[model samples]
Target: MAPSRILMAAIVLVGLSGFADAPQRYVVSYSVSDHGVAQMRGQALISEEGDVSVQGSDQDGGHAFNATLNPTDDGLVLVTSLWRGATKLGEPTLAMERGGQAKAEFGSDQQRVVIEIAPAD
Candidate 1:
């Protein structure tokens, strides 16, 4: 092989590797409904490690939660907690679909939440 051709190939490989190492970022927005009222509006960050950070506002001040996601046979299972100051308020079971939607239920299914994501504007 010619020396110039070999150098060009090496440059292409380096550029390709850089592209492969880039991280993916997604912004998810969702709402929760309770009784006949839409109670909350929130957003979450889904990272490469399947870790999530979510925050929203409702009638009860502002709320934030964090959890790690693990893939299951049925779907993605999430364990989340509510926080106020340094106190741990509640932990709940949540479910997520890869590249789809997610929901978290609270208080005996009295509350149902839905999350959806799309390309950022």
Candidate 2:
């Protein structure tokens, strides 16, 4: 192959490797329900290894969630903590692959939180 062509191919491969390591962005959506009634719903944008926290209050109580989007060899994992009022809801995690979606539900009938994560558009 021509020397120029070899150099161009190397440049292209390096550029593609840079893209592979580029940070990924995702949309995180959640819903907090009290006794099966929607108490709060919110959305946030996050990047790989970024943290997001959201909280809201209503007449009944307050709802809050903290989560981090982390990358893994197999897929992505959302490490999260959920809370309703002063009580801490169960810690839930959503695991998904690239270009996929995942959800984690915590709590029971009294207070519940559902978190969904997806690759951002």
Using TM-score as the measure, the top candidate is 2
Give candidate 2's total backbone clashes: 0
Each prediction's TM-score versus the true structure: 0.49, 0.71
- Give the number of the best model, judged by lDDT: 2
Candidate 2 lDDT over 32-119, as tens digits, reads 7889998788888888789999888878788788889888999888888777788887678878887688887777899777889887
lDDT of 1 by residue, 5-108 (tens): 99999999999999877644456555556764767656676643467766665556676666655567765655656553455545665565644445544443
Superposed model 1: Cα runs more than 4 Å off: 1-5, 17-30, 57-59, 70-77, 82-110, 113-121
Count of backbone collisions in candidate 1: 0
Q: Candidate 2, which segments miss by more than 4 Å at Cα?
A: 1-21, 106-111
**Clash-forming residue pairs, model 1:** none
